[model samples]
Target: MSSSDHPNISGSSQPLLHQKGKEIQEFGTVNQVPLGLSYDARLYACQRLNRVLADTRMLYSLYKKHHWLMRGATFYQLHLLLDKHADEQLALVDVLAERVQALGGVAVGDPRHVAELTSIPRPPDGVEEVPAMLSRLLSAHEAILIDARDAAARVAALGDDGTNDLLVSQVVRTGETQVWFLAEHLVDTPLVRL
Candidate 1:
């Protein structure tokens, strides 16, 4: 067949791969936006949201790990609960990332970048006892909740209502509910009275 008959198969063109270039937008800088928010407000909100986004990613990781590692008497229930919670956290990650972008800042995309930004402590590589694992999740939730509270207040003060609403209405509320669920699993209660 003539090369012109199958242009796609011609040896003249190849796919672009392994391309690298300088970053167009630097991290920690916000572009001017016309969302009725001042540049400073947008900048501050993006900074706070990115920090929470990083921690939420870590929390999501913890939930997945614990969900898979759930064992002992309440394994089935705890496993299902952790997986559900993980899914919720995943949803929050997307929402949080988009919020940062809406503020005209770069959302931290790389897992390595998230690791560098997250304040949540790294857990052991091995599986922990069931209660210990549950406790670890609660601790992660606590960290996120604390940050959410502070960030929400600061963003509100900065006149970034959208960011404030997201931190309070979504981040804080979700973390608090998840914490309640995880904490209940650690209580010394039997499935039924002996």
Candidate 2:
């Protein structure tokens, strides 16, 4: 190796690797952000938003799962619907995470962490009956809608309109629409009346 081989290289240039450091910002804490929100408001919004983010991720995973395992006469329709819902949930996941970051708080990103924080129950490993799978989805959506409605109201009371709008406009509305779709699938309507 010649010294002139690399013009910008200093003697013994090695990349810094395997670096470890203490946590800069712990979970459940917020930084000092001048976004016109008080500390309590920011912290409260972060806490609520992170919970919703976790559940949204879980719901996305569930949608993917059910979509893959979907079977029967409605399989074709369900496969597409579940996938569409999953994509929307994934988008919400990003939006929720960014909202948390914007509030100067850490967004829960790890699957393991999300599993811990999510209120949604885990479905069985094996496929359930199609009705059961749809029921599970409806249940998850209901859980999220319940929390979202409460959180939206509380955050609005705290004077955090952005978070309130996100919870109500995006989370609550999407959840309600999806639940309506899923619930209809369980209806005992005859395609051809006798």
Candidate 3:
């Protein structure tokens, strides 16, 4: 019945549960690739992927925030759409992080780290009007698309075909499609009239 009698309690004889390890690699650095690509190419691809990863993470967060805060006559539709977009963005986040690791670079996993790397403007912490929220999402999508297009082109020039393909096929395509969907919601066309 005493505190000292508890088996899991930490004491002079009990040790902590976790072990610490030395840092193996630093962020923003990549090791040489044996997969027929030069060190410079892998390094460049990793750098580009990390940037995309950071922005995708921020976009995903925005989607989730808007999903929960969705309102008005379009609440049901917008809620589902935001959640779907968030899921897609989450998938891209995984792909991007894996691509970074494949290149022997550390992915920016920490949100604080991501915030520092992301170019997407931060939204208001509190909820805004649905139009403002949708606009915010549209802007974030455009920012990612612009960066992805440029990065894809540059990586292709660097002979990083895999990274280039992913940026174009996944990141760029997904962002463009999402932008289209979000933009349509902002059109002033009346649902019941012209």
* Top TM-score model: 2
Q: Write the per-residue lDDT of candidate 2 for residues 141-192, one digit (tens) a residue.
A: 9899999999999999999999999999999988898999889999998999
lDDT per residue for candidate 3 within 83-179, as digits (tens), equals: 9999999999999999999988899999999999999999999989999999999989988999999999998998888899999999999998999
User: Clashing pairs in model 2?
Assistant: none
The TM-score values for the models, in the order shown, are 0.91, 0.92, 0.90
- What tens digits encode model 1's per-residue C-alpha lDDT throughout 1-194? 86556656648365545789998999999988789999988988889999999999999999999998888978999899999999999999999999999889999999999999999999999999998998889988999999999999998998888999999999999999999988877678766997
Model 3 residue runs over 4 Å out of place are: 1-16
Candidate 1 pairs with clashing backbones: none
